[model samples]
Target: MALAYDDTNIFARILRGEIPCDKVAENDHALAFRDINPQAPVHVLVIPKGAYVSLDDFAANASDAEILSFTRLCAQVCTSEGVHLAGGHDGFRAIANAGPHGVQEVPHYHLHILGGRVMGPMLARKA
Candidate 1:
């Protein structure tokens, strides 16, 4: 089931130009910008221009062209940001938080590209 699209989300505002963002890269289908609160030295966010609540929503509702474009734009952003350096010797991590359990703060779907340092484990081990 597709979730309702929230046009009032911060990302939507950014995409609509209602708000300003430190833009990194933009293509026909996606827009990338530096995160206001970054977790890593190189923290960028890539989002599809279309409105989707989460990754599942995006996968279910977005067109094939939108999917391909968004994915390609993400890789382009990584390359432009030099995240994958020296022929992939250095790499970055792309993350998408889902619902409440996944810690998704924003309603709109986005991919967080984090790198520029050794990204440690994703979670701490439970003792």
Candidate 2:
């Protein structure tokens, strides 16, 4: 039997075309779509095609080649999206949250590529 993974979640639905999304990029191994609740001027989420759950899950489930391809796609997206800037802290920030402690809203393993301006920390900072 095949390995188990929940494919009924929202992002998984988007991956399966059960839900429509503002698609930014896609490859055989991954798909990139815009964030519905964008935190930055350019906020896109990249997910592995067969992702069943969180990064922890994906990490455990995905093959080594899959992981490598994911990293390559991350670089590719950064390039294609014009997120790579010359100066430090001037480009996009790729984020993959593992679980609740990591602020992962969606269960699927997804990376938030946020850029287009100076970005702050993920958490609210005290004054």
Candidate 3:
């Protein structure tokens, strides 16, 4: 399905310099920043500099350089946040929500890197 990306989304605004973000790291194709409403002690968001509405959109459409930049930034954030296993930290969770079922709040593709504490089960058991 072709998802229509909303350029007016908050992340788009941030990228356009209309909104300020607590930036962690950035490259030509991607940007990593601290989430304003953090859910973990180490909460960083990695986003590609393209108009993608979801992870699948990014995966299928992004160029090799864009993909590499986004992936590298994610790893960079993990290590710098002290959550990378190689960095002697337990680990971190990378989450990308999509569509209505995924409860995606923004229309831009973004990865949430959460860590600094033991994250319990990936999700609550469906009752």
Best candidate, lDDT: 3
RMSD of each: 1.7, 3.9, 1.0
Candidate 3 has its poorest 10 consecutive residues by lDDT at 1-10
Ranking by TM-score: 3, 1, 2
TM-scores of all predicted structures? 0.93, 0.81, 0.96
CA deviation > 4 Å runs, candidate 1: 1-3, 85-88
Per-residue CA lDDT of model 1 for 1-127, tens digit only, reads 3346779999999999999999998888899999999999899999999989899989988999999999998888888888876586588999999887888888899999999998999889999
**Local distance difference test, per candidate?**
0.90, 0.78, 0.93
lDDT at 3, model 2: 27
Error of 2 at 103 (Å): 2.8
Q: Model 1: which residue pairs collide?
A: none
Question: Model 2: clashing residue pairs?
Answer: none
Model 3 segments more than 4 A misplaced: none
Residues 1-127, model 3: lDDT tens digits: 6568989999999999999999999999999999999999999999999999999999999999999999999988998899999946799899999988899989899999999998899998986
